[model samples]
Target: MTLFIGIVIFLVTFVFMEFMAWFSHKYIMHGFLWVLHKDHHHKDHDSWFERNDAFFIIYAVVSMSFIITASNTWFWYGLPIGFGIMAYGAAYFLVHDIFIHQRFKLLRNANNWYARGVRRAHKIHHKHLGKEEGECFGMLFVPFKYFKK
Candidate 1:
């Protein structure tokens, strides 16, 4: 593919990952796989990591597989796709782990409209502490109601 097309594909993939994050968080994480995701809602462990972190490894493996395929095979578009997944994963880590959960005591002063909205939405979501009756499964694309002044 052309450079422009590759960039477009990369951008699209980045955007698409938001929806995937939402869908996976709602249906998969909160569904049959709640056993792994429950720790994220509640701090039942003394360790710094949660069982939900397994999903990061899964996505890393997927991105690495795409990259390996691109390097060894003829499908070069996989490079953009792989990087897009990796970039989204990094953003998710920053926003969810660092900003929202304060896992590292960073971004605690972001205090912007988007930051406030995201934090509020996530706080509302964590209020459930259970798989069912959860709201705001999204990370980036939060509902506007949370942003209202």
Candidate 2:
């Protein structure tokens, strides 16, 4: 029962994570909270926290709560929710820190199709002015033309 529940949670969480990625990037990261995220772009060197990657801390805590209490279906709902949040964090960490920004480029070695797409998309986002940040709102599945304009 526990393992089955975990698998179910994982699939649901992937969807939720994708949606959360869209929402947070579209509204939060590019919106008012860009003040903190801006440090990531402007700083010459990034410390452990200055990278502004700590945003996932909140998601981790919330998802952990659900996983811990997931005996019931109600709690099981949190499995996917938590997984989604973690997925976003992982995607952000891998894509932004590893590929696009090259903050931790040592760990990155290859440039696959998705990686190239995401890097190009994010580059376009960075090149645009503040008002034009809307082009690459979707992180994992964005169309290239969205940023071409």
Candidate 3:
């Protein structure tokens, strides 16, 4: 029963991370913290990294905290929660950075309906080079309108 509960908690946390991603991207990243996220939209530096990468570090720290707490506490639930957050972060990095932005050039030839849709939606979002007026959407749950025919 404990294992089952842990699995459920993990799945729930994974799904909830999507909402958290959208919320943070829209309000926090594009809002007051635009200073960190602006370089993501506009390439102001020659380096391969952006200040926006700090957000990934923040999430990584949160996941690590949960894992460490789970290791020391009786509540093993934090283990799954931590893995769930890390998994979502991995997916986000692959889809957003690798696939969409071609940062690593690994999944460069992945051509599919879903991939195309994600690319299209992200392109629209990047259409605006500023903090405001860009359409921010979840990586896993892109709008149907952006889907290919």
TM-score of each: 0.96, 0.72, 0.97
Q: Candidate 2, residues 12-37: lDDT per residue as tens digits?
A: 77766767777776687778787656
Candidate 1 residue spans exceeding 4 A from truth? none
Worst 10 residues of 1 by lDDT: 135-144
Model 2 misplacement above 4 A:
1-6, 44-48, 71-74, 129-134, 144-149
Choose the strongest candidate by TM-score: 3
Ranking by TM-score: 3, 1, 2
User: Candidate 3, which ten residues in sequence have the lowest lDDT sum?
Assistant: 105-114
Candidates 1 and 3 compared: the better one by lDDT is 3
The digit string of per-residue lDDT tens for model 1 on 1-71 reads 49998899889888889999998888999998999999999889999989999999988998899899999
Arrange candidates, best lDDT first: 3, 1, 2
| Per-prediction backbone clash count | 0, 1, 0
Residue 146 alpha-carbon offset, candidate 1, angstroms = 0.5
Better of 2 and 3 by TM-score: 3
TM-score of 3: 0.97
What CA RMSD would you report for each candidate? 1.0, 3.8, 0.8
